[model samples]
Target: MNNRDEPANAVPRRAVLAGLAVLAGAAACSGGPVGPRRLRIASSAGDLGAGLADLVNRHLRDVEASVVTPMASAGTVDLIARGEAEIGLSQTDLLGVDASVTALARVYDDLLHLVVPADHPITTVDDLRGRRVSVGETGSGTAVTAGRLLAAAGLTAGAYVRSERSLDNATAALTRGDLDAFFFSGGLPVARIRELSARTRIRIVDLSGWAGALRSTYSDVYVVRNVPTSTYQAPPSATIADATLLLASASLPDALAYDVTRLLLERRDVLAVAHPALEALDVRSAAATMPAPLHPGAARYYRSVKP
Candidate 1:
């Protein structure tokens, strides 16, 4: 997500604006202020975006003031770094270490799903050699992971007949038997994956074996997670996982950031109703993924809530 370079002067300017924005918001609440305390939030295109949008509409409408715009996950990071959006949602791996976006909370874990028909015989990443496979769409967060995982497994780009199409297209190809398998990374209960499971028998190829290779070759952003058979009606399987984090721009005022963090942590029960995945939020480890330093305001909030 940090492929774009951030300008040197942007950070301090954002810091100043955040302070001013706080004063303006305070004045407004006192009955003599300006417009609503508007916050522009950017998020990914699927469940992550939709789920956050739902939270903002239902809970943050009056508490902190906000609006949400959905876009590619990488694009969202660029927006936050440039101060175009005060907040964003992205997979931790995509944010990398150099990205300016700071993580406020680790929302949930997203798993790498290598899906194939249940009867397809291929049981491991090694078995995918010489087979037609969809790695994910070009420039997608999932695509980045797919490439790294393949390289870690000693499979070059040309090792197989590669399809760099959208998950929708890949799902269609897999359903029609035109592709051997495909890769996807997302929280559980992905609609497309669920639809594919219902339409035909499918199984997620276990990827736990590649976790060590991933850590040794790259960063330790990946982990092994067991996908319950109840998730998609397949037998329990092990795979690699990465956290999805709520990111904030450094320019967002410390006060506003504090409020937002408090809201999310205090309102977990409300959020869990929309998506049970959110219920897994562990505040104790929310800031464990140091993709970037914790924003000062978020740090204050976490410290206040810590026992």
Candidate 2:
């Protein structure tokens, strides 16, 4: 009884029409096939980054978005810089280290979680001296921020016994009492941390004191924020926070970038269902990607939407 040329799930015609206004010449100029543009979004394997990629893939039907997990925020940047991925999710602090990428939006904040056993006597960064800790896997954003925090606290390399392990590995090591503490930078209510806390009493160290020192040494990319008591059923604590940016390759076409930015803002409510962290995305602060300049296309979109 129903005969149609396109599939039932095909992108709505209105959405396609909306893109045509800005991307009129994209198809003509692109040497590749005229079909939907293929986009690879680089991110860590199983964190918010992957959730974001899935969100884009589901809603942005104009482009075929795929997730390319390099397992670390720094690796995501590397993939974008190398042209292996067109989009990436990374920490704002790492943006200054790469020039081949530009930001699309300041998606959300990742709080520094210095987790230790609740019963442990370590009360502050100073207590970590001569203790076993994991700074996160090599090339991870956690490693970069954790190292900075330790240095700011005057805990030099030789002051602590250090290991580099992924978040999952570190969580397991801590649960087994193999590690005295571990540092992980992620959105609040991190599933791994929450799950770990449910079974084992865990405490998140407060790093609010080092916020000013980090900003003085680095940039304003670091902010002091509180992880609420409900996050992991632990006492509320303050920590150094950094923005997580949705970035695009500098060479991305302006039209494509504009379309991507537009979709992100327009369909935010729908995307938020996949990950609550997306609920933090606000058009008001989306353009404020300091240190890393906004992509020209993204800037254009923001300007067009200005009231």
Candidate 3:
């Protein structure tokens, strides 16, 4: 079992609902009634998006106009453009890359922690020089955030610090003494980080000073935060880090997107249980979270929502 301890089935616990919606899409594509369409939401299984998939489905179940389909992790831009999934989690950095999809809501932030072996020679993002690093899977938000942050510090992918592997594999490599440092984005205290912490000494590199500069370069989309030492049982108590997380879709119907957004706002408690960070999700800050524009439909909701 991967140290995740989360079940494979647990990843898309909303499979039945999602499968039904997939069928609905196929039916619509095949020229069926396409009546009261079901909306499919693509989320990386076993990731933070997956954790919220169920919460989203539960709230969306009663909406007769549409259904929310949960999907495994794939390309966020592709899924939305192809109409395979109407809603999916997107890296905040993807705002200008495509004009097709739009931001329905602002999900919580994915933390970009620079991890290293406890005794390693690195203490900040700048110290990554002359060492091996993992910037996350290519085409991943991790790569975007890691690359930009490193660039802000005068480095480049595979140039300044060699990117070894994805966050999952990199964590394993780090434990085996193969990687010097790794940076990736995900909900705080993610399973991978927790697993690594249990077996090897690890730390969330502090990046408070450079955050402002990074924000300027990467779009104010990246928020600066401090992951408490308590987050991973590390040595320090407070440490600043970069943020990377957002939600979007190019295919989601404006009305349907509005409903899903409304659904989440109404059921704050359920989402809070999955990730405490969601406690801060709100309509007002939704657009500010994305580097680009918010979905026109979602923008409508945000404007009408007072306070």
Q: Which candidate has the top score in lDDT?
A: 2
What order do you get sorting by TM-score, best first?
2, 1, 3
Q: Give the per-residue lDDT digits (tens) of candidate 1, residues 225-296.
A: 998988888878999988878888877779877877776777777766655677777678775646667888
Clashing pairs in 2: none
lDDT against the true structure, per candidate, is 0.78, 0.85, 0.66
Model 1 TM-score? 0.80
Clashes, model 1 = 1
User: Tens digits of per-residue lDDT for model 3 on 1-73?
Assistant: 3336666646454666899999989988999854445556566544545544555556565443322333323
Clashes of each: 1, 0, 1
Per-model TM against the reference = 0.80, 0.83, 0.71
lDDT of 3 at 149: 74
Candidate with best TM-score: 2
Candidate 3: worst 10 consecutive residues by lDDT? 65-74
